[model samples]
Target: MPKMIFVNLPITDLDRSISFYEAVGGRREPKFSNDRAAMIVLSDTISVMLLTHDFYSTFTRKPIADAHRTSQVLLALSADSVADVDATIDKASSAGGKVDPGPKQEMGDLMYGRSFEDPDGHHWEIMWMDPQAAEQGASAFEQA
Candidate 1:
């Protein structure tokens, strides 16, 4: 079997978080979900595990940091195009998330990325890379 990634998030509200993820294009997997936990499938190999604070504590003994005020990690998703990146940010905003919570990243003719904060304050970024340019690596573009 191929490798897969499950991003487990500590959330305050399970239902609301599920809705937010759905609005941002994730499909909920009922087989792995219950009242206290949910699995949101983002892609073929990527899924998000939304766990209530109580449930999440069982997995880690450390205190759960408030994502709103901390910056331990920044999650990013790939987009098919620059327009898709912008559309994702818009979807996040429509779902009550904070758009552009982090710095905007722009790479001339190479890449484009936008940021958003989920309702629980989890920072996320949607990015797109020029396929042709990416195939040649950033160094090749730098020399142009």
Candidate 2:
């Protein structure tokens, strides 16, 4: 079986978070979801577990940091093309997520990326890269 990644996040509103994730190419997996938590399946191997603050705290002794005020991690996903990257970001924004919480990223055709903040301010980055450049290394694209 292929390995999978489940990212657990602390959110305030389960319903809203579920909707936001859905807008960004995710669908709620009811078998693993409940009132306090929702399992958003972003891809075959990528899932985001949205847990309320109270529920999330149960998994860790450390205090829950407010994502809106602090940064803990940046979650990134790859896209097939630059248009796809932008489309994801656009959908996120339409779903009420903040667009471009940080500056947009462009690496002269080598890579293209953009960021957005979920309702709870969790950061997400959508990116696309030149396939050949990625396999060949950035130096391969360097000018003479």
Top of the candidates by lDDT: 1
For all predictions, the C-alpha RMSD in Å is 1.2, 1.5
Model 1 poorest 10 in a row by lDDT: 135-144
lDDT of 1 by residue, 11-54 (tens): 99999999999999999999999998999999999999999999
Give the TM-score of each candidate: 0.95, 0.95
For residues 113-135, could you state the per-residue lDDT of candidate 2 as single tens digits?
99999999999999888998888
Q: Residue 141 in candidate 1 has what lDDT?
A: 61
Q: Which stretches of candidate 2 lie over 4 Å from their true place?
A: 138-144
